[model samples]
Target: MSVSNPTLITFVIYIAAMVLIGFMAYRSTNNLSDYILGGRSLGSVVTALSAGASDMSGWLLMGLPGAIYMSGLSESWIAIGLIIGAYLNWLFVAGRLRVQTEHNGDALTLPDYFSSRFEDKSGLLRIISAVVILVFFTIYCASGIVAGARLFESTFGMSYETALWAGAAATIAYTFVGGFLAVSWTDTVQATLMIFALLLTPIIVLLATGGVDTTFLAIEAQDPSNFDMLKNTTFIGIISLMGWGLGYFGQPHILARFMAADSVKSIANARRISMTWMILCLGGTVAVGFFGIAYFSANPDLAGPVTENHERVFIELAKILFNPWIAGVLLSAILAAVMSTLSCQLLVCSSALTEDFYKTFLRKTASQVELVWVGRAMVLLVALVAIALASNPENRVLGLVSYAWAGFGAAFGPVVLISVIWKDMTRNGALAGILVGAITVIVWKHFEVLGLYEIIPGFIFASLAIYIVSKLGAPTAGMLSRFAAAEADFRLNK
Candidate 1:
């Protein structure tokens, strides 16, 4: 298949705009805080869109659709779970995290926050937390690369390896130059593009297919079971699907958005905006998959993409239904989703390296300029590692994403939640929780033990570890006082 010029040009223009934003951010950045957290200057709109964009990733465009197409309404439990999870996270954690991170030793990264929150003089919290971030984020970053590679492979027909690097190159360049500001700005644009693409695609499909009734009829005729939400589903399957929502609490990239909000007040508006965007976008996403089922059922000749890789259902529908020009814009949305999330993951990894590891351990006296450059270098280094992991063209985007999501959810979710609200949580308990959560996720995935999602087991085990260990261990008198003070300060400020 020949490459469409309109699509190529649209992608080029979009990418160029992102690079331009990066340069602008670079000019504004003067310190590590400015580089890492956009100097906590993000208002409601930017924070809302950026968080949504980074959290959704290509999964919104590709994985969600693919899951719906392959499994029908049963797959939607994940979307429902995520929506509830995201709402709870914003409602409970956003304001608290925003206030606490700034107050608690001016923590720049999650690890830094944990270390300062518990007053870990030995720095073990920083080291262990940084390692968990690196390991899972490397895997998380690979999922985005794979999604981008899939887009290029489908749109341009390039070889997988070439597409892989091409997909990663711009994300690395923009993030390396601009850091947090570039990432947040570009995510806003990408979020808009993604929402538009999702909204438009399903509307066009409904029109072409005659209406909602005919669309459902088409899907039902193909396999009557497709209409059932619990077709052959076990209790475990339902729980596993909904368990995806729980992962939202612990995601470092999403948490970073909370940390970067201009103020605790901005978080409320941001939450309202983000929740609306998420519901509409998620509905549109599911519609794409549902519509794909109808369109392909009626036209079996065009079902190869679906049959071969269900994730390509959205891509195939865009190419088939729209002219090359409109198709390019639609396809570019996929790229936008991929890049937006990938850039955030890279920047967070860079922050962990620079703030948690490099500045904290290796170069305590490093200048702001030196730290920023080191952060930039870390972005490239982390990107390269992710590229290696994504080199396999057959890697499934959702599968990889699920693994990393569970890792963070199980590892950090309970700890972050309890630490923010509970004054009696000991440093030993936090340490134990992190170790248990991370280890449980790894072991659960490795052994394939429960047939349940790893996050369920990991999260449960981690929470228990924290509670049990804290009950057994001694808390510093000073740490208890500080926790009380911070808790009171957050409540008063709120």
Candidate 2:
């Protein structure tokens, strides 16, 4: 039973709700901070969902399913790496980052906080960091846009090019008006819906097609490699694959949530919620893809072009179990993953330009209102650039993400980790780590493949670069004591 009238209604209703939620979020936003960080007042639930939802995005919708559909349960290892990594980041980085950023001042963007944190009074660090962000995030947002286009083109009959434009326009509409508040609140809603879709679709598939044992038997019969975790998978492949987990560290969009949280105490609760959501949703997605092969194998028509095009597993399962109406409602979850992440990326990119660069240098006297418009202009600029890259229709979503994700993970993750804890970490080390991380990811991607994952390799080298550079060229010796005293002072005052 392919998608029927009921499925169409569900899809329309789901899309409409996303737009409506964005509008509702717009009402709560009064200023840049409100627009960007929900007034720094988001509780644990919102923070956790937004963070998880934004983090998973195209990787979950297109990449994960494709992996499972092609590789089998061995793909589940990636989920393990990601969930564990996310939990640790929340536990270690989120609380400290939130407290330190707010305590230093109310600067909203990541580069703003970085510049201020390291006392880069010349504004050079902030500007440079902002530039790196723009360069990488543009590619990141492009991947999400590509995923969005794929969802529409595959699930619907829409052309990929048209879908790209429409998706961008729709995401831009909600994002431009709603800002970060709208993105986060709407993401919470979308994330909930995404979990619903991930949990339900595969469960129905398993029940309909006998059970887990039967599904496994079917997959193994088709190809023994289906059960092989390491089949065609290399050390670099595994590392590069799992290394994706490392991306959580330097991610400006996700990290900014930590910066704006209501309090450090919330990180504990948010961590629990976020890790649980990631495991469940990601685990379910992998299941859906693996089960799909067994499912469609019993009914050959469901199988399409091979080559691990399992990206359509969710859509295929939806059409199989439910009416077209249910399928539509369910399919929007992928859209949620794509758009939620894209919205967050676009906003952060714009903020980097308007807040970190423009305000930092060109117009010290620029009014808040003018800066806001500059951010708006930057949004358009980024949207145009990303869409242009996405129009090719041949861009592989996962490949693009792997490169950009590794770049950020290696570049920003280590420095961010050390910065909050190691007072002796010099600005020079921060700069070196970021450059090495970003450069390593790019060079390795184009020149040499890592043992397991691009991110893992990039992270190791980036970290080594920072550690060695710091050891060789030290920071102010007394700064560590002063930093500790300052943290205590802030706590006492509070």
TM-score of each: 0.98, 0.94
Error of 1 at 23 (Å): 0.7
Q: Ten-residue segment with the worst summed lDDT in candidate 1?
A: 485-494
Segments in model 2 whose C-alpha atoms lie over 4 Å from true places: 1-5, 305-308, 450-452, 473-482, 485-494
What is the TM-score of candidate 1? 0.98
Q: Candidate 2 lDDT, tens digit per residue, 1-494? A: 22356765776676677777778877786666776677799888999999989888877867888878877877777887787678778866887787677755666987877776677778777877888898889999999998888777776668888779866777887888778888898889889989998999889899878898888888888887887888877775665566667789899889988877787667788888988898889878888888887888888865764334666677667766876667777888888888889999999998988888787778989876677678778888999999988888888888778777877888899988888777777777888888888888777777665345657767888888878887776666444554675466445532
Model 2 poorest 10 in a row by lDDT: 485-494
Best by TM-score: 1
Predict model 1's lDDT versus the native: 0.92
The model with the greatest lDDT is 1
TM-score: model 2 vs. ground truth = 0.94
**Clashing residue pair totals per candidate (backbone < 3 A):** 0, 15
